[model samples]
Target: MRGATAWSSPIDPMAAEFQVPVYFDYLATFSWALSGAIVALRKRCDIVGVFVLALLTSVGGSILRDGIFLQRTPPVLTDPVYLPLITLATLLIALLHQHIIHLQVVDKLVSTIDAIGTPAFAVVGMQLALDAGIPLPGVILVGAVSSVGGGVLRDVIVREIPFILQAGQFFALVVLLACIVFLVLTLALQVATVHAAWATIGLFFVVRTLTIRYNWQTRPLLRDEDH
Candidate 1:
């Protein structure tokens, strides 16, 4: 108790209308839409499918976050810019489909974009949860959902397993770690919210990029006898 960090005074709900920076939100939205559109193209989807996937992957997480947890209008609906951003992503994929598919850097480009968007959305969701006065566990949950919920929807629609549910790179795990680190920094260490968010995002990006570079993977809890 002697060494415990003092909890900050309660935040006023009215004053708690926290916002993720416009640039961060829009950049992440576009990156995710681009990733989704690429996947749609790889699956041989038509232009309509590209748009559908782009829209879902760009906004599905925020939809789940607001509708289920925050219980408010999702920013994709309230903000005028989000849809246009997704449309731009779709158009880019539409016009450059052949070039993108043939580029040697496509994999690396998608990985880089994913690394950026994942932490960005996680931080955004974590901030929203903190402003809403949710419990710490709920905050982590919101962050993970906001990071991967869109990909889950896209995968399901395409009849493939969701990345979060699969034993692959540390996607949801990284998000959870990021959210926990943010809470520890802001709540326990008393760091400023913006600084803590940036630190967490940086940490997540570094760890995620390293894992991808090294082919670090999660193994099955129970291995199959055939293997």
Candidate 2:
């Protein structure tokens, strides 16, 4: 007990640390894992390769994150439930890849999931860093990295342009908005972070869906060649 300030349990909403963040992290990580499986099989990888890609894509960034924060082995590896869940997700995607590709809502699903992942991961990262007593800006930086880390790794592994860099997309924009909402509500305004987190989720879903529906995009830098 450090003076009067004992570490609060995660069950307390106001507590700085949350235990189930790993579970949420799993959801955030699934897209990359599934994408790995899809791209691997598409590239004609063997069974070993598929699972290898799955494991790497799902947990690589988390491993790197833990290493960065000096946590050994990564929580996803130490935790028993996460691997099975990721395995199930990858298997489902592998088996149903055909159906997945054909879904008219597939684009929407990716957008929705990426939206959820941003706030979920970012808020969790922020809380973790805060619990460890890091400064706010550092917390924000780490949070942003956690929010998009796996997806960036996944895209690079699959030899595709990272979704964040792809023009005409809302991928990183969702995460950026999420991070801002988290930092503002939790740090600056001293409001309920959980509610603020969900607000970001709703905000991302609405804005992303609109962007997709309206074919929205920020135009590239102009050149004078045509003019």
Candidate 3:
């Protein structure tokens, strides 16, 4: 019974102390769900497909981060808010599909929303890993997975290559760099504050947005003739 009390504790100190991160986590979920729903619409999928993509895009990375990496219950199972939010996103997208499809800015808007979510999730994952006493590499891995895992799953499910594998946009690189910067600031430099976390997020958002706006891309490794 020595460790029983610790195991049965009802409140997690980390969860209670970080209200802002929790709020941003849910916001990221909604943003990611919206992106997936838009993709579903682009594919001419029905309402059910939209729901599936939304759910997957919103929670898929967290599922892997928690269930597979951390060996804990997935947040989608423990948190009641995720499903309702995803459902709401699906419904809203369905309602606005006609107008959304016609808007020339739709692609840019979706990309921006997705970019907003990436750094938030990356910070969340880094904090969680640090709290769990994971090592530096594991922390970075968790952060990267939390940021891009869901999008990768969404793309794979839709039969498209994952964005990270594509030679452009610095998408996955942004997540990795952000995570590394966060770990350096908070762990190595001993600056343990939410502000540091937000700084990392801001850096990621700006760099990612600039890359998108400028059409920056990694140089292609193989030319058509070389291949």
Show how many residue pairs clash in every candidate, following the order shown: 0, 0, 0
**Local accuracy of candidate 3 as per-residue lDDT tens digits, 1-227:** 01224333432535522833677788889988988898899998999999999999989998998889866688888878899999999999999998988786877776786777888888887666666666679879998998888989999999998978888766777788888898788767877658777788789889988997897888668978897
- In order, what lDDT does every prediction score? 0.82, 0.65, 0.81
lDDT of 3 at 159: 96
**Model 3: what TM-score?**
0.90
Query: Which residue pairs overlap in candidate 2's backbone?
Result: none
lDDT, candidate 3, equals: 0.81
What TM-score would each prediction reach against the true structure? 0.89, 0.77, 0.90
Per-residue CA lDDT of candidate 2, range 52-118, in tens?
6777766765665556762535667666866786788667877787787767586556657765666
Q: Give the runs in model 2 whose Cα sits over 4 Å from its true position.
A: 1-23, 69-72, 222-227
* RMSD (CA, angstroms), candidate 2: 4.6
Span of ten consecutive residues with least summed lDDT in model 2: 1-10
Best by lDDT: 1
After the best TM-score superposition of candidate 1, give how far the Cα of residue 189 lies from its true spot, in angstroms. Answer: 0.6
Where does model 1 exceed 4 Å of error? 1-19
